[model samples]
Target: MLKNIFMLFISQGVNYLVPLILVPYLVRTLGAESYGEFNLALSIILYGCLFIDFGFNLYTTGEISKTENKEKIRHLYTVTIASKFLIFFPVALIIIFTVNNVSQFDNIKSVCYILIIQMLSSVISTVWLYQGLEKIRIYSLVNVVVKLLMLPMIFTLVRDTNDINILATIQSVSFLLSALLLITIAKRYDIYLVKINFSDIRSILSSASHIFTGTISVSLYTMSTPIILGLVNTAFEVGQFSATDKIRGAFISIFLILSNVIYPRINKLKVDNEFLAFRFIKKITMIQFFLGLTFATAIYYSAPYIVINYLGSEFQESIDLLRLMSPMVILVPLSVILSNYVLLTWNYKKYYLCVPLITCIFHFSYIIPLSHYYGAIGSGIGILITEFISFSLLLIFSLKSGMLRKIYES
Candidate 1:
């Protein structure tokens, strides 16, 4: 577990560090508006990648972990390829139409086009295969190398504001290279790319649909905010929201390293000693909460200093927005427990499906209005509210359904 966490930390550090380092540079060079345009295009690429992924991370990875039959593994590999190509055509068309038809995206249409590399690479990279096989070192090595390569490319090429397209292209190609590496290395598994019949494809998609919806719903809420802000407000406001969110999101991601380490562990634990795992989880929950509280307090008090010092004077308005979102740090770890551990451990997989739907409901009902009226600050407030609501909903639903009791009774 320590080895896995350490490896993940190295890879995740590279992933998180590059973007945070670029924020101040990009903000100063591109200014808020253009930087936000880059963010918006990136968001679209995110959802496009999400569509191609279709919950294969959890569903397919879980499937791969469940069995060792090479025939079955080969079949899973073939169907995954088939399913992604099946999903990709329509998604590409949608991307084409969205950039051409969507007025907000008119300026960065080139960025969107270049990001097709990113979208396609997301499907082909197959990090999930390593995670499933528990050969996590390979996954960590690939991500870290690509991220390091991207650092030099970004610094060399993205010297000016007009280079957002170049920056996007560099990032996309890094992903493509990573995918190519994965494809090359994957042959070690002796997996062959065979033709999957339509029935095989249908059964794969059918079994995976709920997981897919949950993934899409998650992308819709978390990744859609910047895009929605673009539709509702100017790109500058998206800059304000995204600037602070980048920091907050990165920190939350770092804290939840436990999630990746513990999740598959729980898969093993539940089989042998679920009661012990439940008790262990109680300790983890407390640790997460206190860590969250500490970060929240620090952000609330010091956002101004951090923003002004790290982000420069141009991002002063983000101080308030950052503070508004501070509490989110507190809820993230708890949410991870509910969503990643509890739901998966207790044979309540369907419960996991419903949480993101509720999050979407809160998005449309509360977040959109708040974003429309109050801009980024409103969006921050809505995030706080929805996060609390999600935490509450998951707890309440578990208790009501006796999943909570099952944990204690174990």
Candidate 2:
């Protein structure tokens, strides 16, 4: 598990740093307007990626971890892949129609279109397979190497605002290449692709539908932030929010990497011994909570310095937004542990779905007003509010479910 954590950190470092390094460059070269446009397009593409994923990362990982049969694993992989492909058509159409028709997307329609390749790449990823198998070194290596390779190309090709399309194209191509490489490496694991009928695809999709809903609702509150900010505020505010959000994202990514490392292992342990799994979750949760609090303090205190050093004086507005949203570093990981590791893994899917469903509703209710009145700062506060609501709901549900009580009593 520690080894997996280390490998993920290495890979995720590349994932986070590319953006961390490029954001200032992109912001400086492309100007706030174009950079904001790029972020808006990227946010829209991320929604497509999330839909294409359809919670396969969690659902399939749990399934694969619990089984030792190579054939079963292969069939699971095939069905999940096929389901994504099947879902892709409708999602693609919705994305295309929305991009072409929506007045907000008019400025970046071409960029959005080119970024559809990222959604396709998400469909092709085999990272979940290696993660489930607890042999993620290859996946991590491939991701790190491919993402690193894209840095030079981006630096070389992206020189002006008009090159925004070229930037999107380059990013999509790198993602596609990484996915294909992962698929090829996955075949070597003996989990090669197999032919599956429509029923097989439907079965996996049906099985994972609850998880899909939770993921989508989660995305609604998380991914929709910048989108809402873009629509309600100006491009410069969006750029500021995006920059600060990326900094907060850097903090959030650490906890998520830990969650990813532990998720399958917890599922595997739960299959053998539920109490043991609960204990594992308990220990990890405390550790994550501590780390999260420490991060929150660091971000809260260091926001001004970070913003000035990383994003420059032009983005000074992002300082307060970064500080305001800093607590999300704590809320998000704890919520993940409670929701994914505790509720969903234990088949408390109703509670799992309810947490995000309710929070997303709360999110949409206030996000518009907040963005409208206070712009980036308001959006930041709105996100923090929703995350707190999610964390509160998850904690309440987890405690009331009696599992945590049982762990204590045992």
Candidate 3:
């Protein structure tokens, strides 16, 4: 477990570091408006990604961890990929049609099309498989290498706003490269493609429906931020929000390292010994909360310094936005623990799904109005409120369902 965590840390370190270097340059070169345009396109494409993924990351990881049969694992692998592509075609068409027709997307229609390559790469990604198998060292290595490779290309090729296509192309190609490498390496784990019938795909999707809905509900506020802001606000504001969100996202990614590493372990423990799994959750929850508070406090206090040094004067708005979003660093970890570790692992998936559903209901009610009135800062408040509601709902649901009570009584 320590080894897996360390490897993921290194991988996430590169993931975070590359963006640390790349984003500043892109923002400086493209200017906030074009940079906002680029992120807006990427954000739209991520919806297609969510459709293609359809909660397979969490569902497959849990499924694969529980089973030992190579044939079953391979079957799951083939069906999952096949289902993604099945969903991909229609989603791709819809996204293309929407971007072309939508007034807001008029400026970034081409960039949106170019970023479809990244979506295709997301379809074939094998990180979930590697994580489930608890053999992610090579997977992490591939990510590190690909990110490093992207740095030089981006610096050399992306020099101006008109080069937005170049930036999208570079990101897409890098994603493809990483996906192909992971596919090759994952073959050793018995992850080869097999003949999957319609029934297989249907069954997998049916089983994953709740998981998929939960994923979408989570995305309602998370991924929809830039899109909503784009629709209601200006590009420059989206750029400012994007900057602070990037910094926030970097920290959240670091916090997720422990969650990812322990997910399969806890699933395995639940299978062998529920008591131990509960105990593990108890221990990790406290640890994760403390770690989250530390991160949130750090970001809150250092927001100005971080903004001044990393984002420059043009991005001064990001300081207050970053502070507004800092609390999410704490909330996200707690939410993950409650939903993934406590609820899902305990088989109270209804509550797990309900948490996000409930949050989304409240979020949509306020996010648009908030973004309409306050722009970046308004959206920041909406996000923080959303996270808090999610965490609170998860905690409440867990208690009402007696999951936490069981954790304590056991």
Candidate 4:
């Protein structure tokens, strides 16, 4: 398990690091205003992708966990690919049409088109199949290779200052390369194109319905920030917040790696030793508490230097936003891990419905008002408050239900 976790971490870490190194250049070249528009458009595409992905990734992983039958897994993979593609086409079309209708940002329409293509190709690749199969090593290697290949593109095409379309092109091509690599690698696992079966489709979709709800709710929390910011504030304001967020995202990557590492193990343990699962959750929660505090403090104190020195001085205003939002960086990992554990060990459907429903209410309620009054700063405060409430609720429920106690005892 540790080795698997390490491999996954290396993969995600490399992927995360590449963007961090490139972000400064990207920001400098694109300028904060353009970068803001670019990120806003990208955020919309990301949310669209989330909607396309629905719950298929998690649902597929759960399916693989239940049955080791190769043929069944293959069929499940095929159906998932088909389903996601079917969803992707319409979403991509909607995005394109929607972008065309928006007269405010002419340059952004092209960027959005590229993003839609990237998202479509990615869904077609069905990369999550490897996760479901527990092939962390292969998955990690594929990621590393893709990042390495993208280096030249970052260095040459995306120079200090370039057209936003060029940057968008690079982003799209990188995604295409990763998707192609996954497709080639997938063949080794015997996941090939096959005629879809209606019964299998029904089963996959039925299981995915719960997962879909959970994912959308989760997506609402994670993806709505940029959307909300864009809606309430200027594109330049969105850019500042997005740039700071890109940095904060790197910090959050550590927790994300940890959560991914433990989720499968928790699922496995829940079948026979619920106590072990509970203990694992407790241990992770405590670690997250301290780690969140440490990183939040470090980022808060260092934001000015980091933003001005590294990403350029134009983004100096982003420092305050970074500090205000840094604490949620910590809460996010704990919340994600706890939520996944709850979904896996308890009533997943109910868990999905409750958490996101609460989160959507608080997040929108706080963010909308705060953004209207104070712009980005208010938005940060709103996020911090929403996360605090949501995390507190999850922690309380975990304890009351004996989940945390069982985890600690184990």
What are the root-mean-square deviations of the candidates from the true structure over C-alphas? 1.9, 1.2, 1.1, 2.0
**Comparing 3 and 4 on TM-score, the stronger one:** 3
Which 10-residue span in candidate 1 carries the lowest summed lDDT? 256-265
What's the lDDT for all of these models?
0.82, 0.89, 0.90, 0.76
Candidate 3: the clashing residue pairs are: none
- Give the 10-residue window scoring lowest on summed lDDT in candidate 2: 401-410
State the lDDT of candidate 3 residue by residue for 347-368, as single tens digits: 7878878888889999999999
Q: Please, what's the RMSD in Å of model 3?
A: 1.1
| Tens digit of per-residue lDDT, candidate 1, span 1-410 | 67777898898898789888878888887889888898889999888889888878777777776677888888888798789888988998899898999888898899999998898888776776776666666777888898888887788888887999998999899999998897788887787687668999999998888888876876677888888888888888898888889989887987765465666667666677878877767777778889889999998999989899878887888999999888889886788787767875576767888988988787778777888888888888887887888888789877877756766655
Ranking by TM-score: 3, 2, 1, 4
Global fold similarity of model 3 (TM-score): 0.98
Better of 1 and 4 by TM-score: 1
Could you tell me every candidate's TM-score relative to the true structure? 0.94, 0.98, 0.98, 0.93
Q: After superposition, how far is residue 60 of candidate 4 from its true place, in Å?
A: 1.0
Order the candidate numbers by lDDT, best to worst. 3, 2, 1, 4
Error of 4 at 346 (Å): 2.5
Candidate 2 off by > 4 Å:
none
**TM-score computed on alpha carbons, candidate 1:** 0.94
**Which pairs of residues collide in candidate 2?**
none
lDDT for model 3, on a 0 to 1 scale?
0.90
**lDDT value, residue 42 of candidate 1:** 90
User: What's model 4's TM-score?
Assistant: 0.93
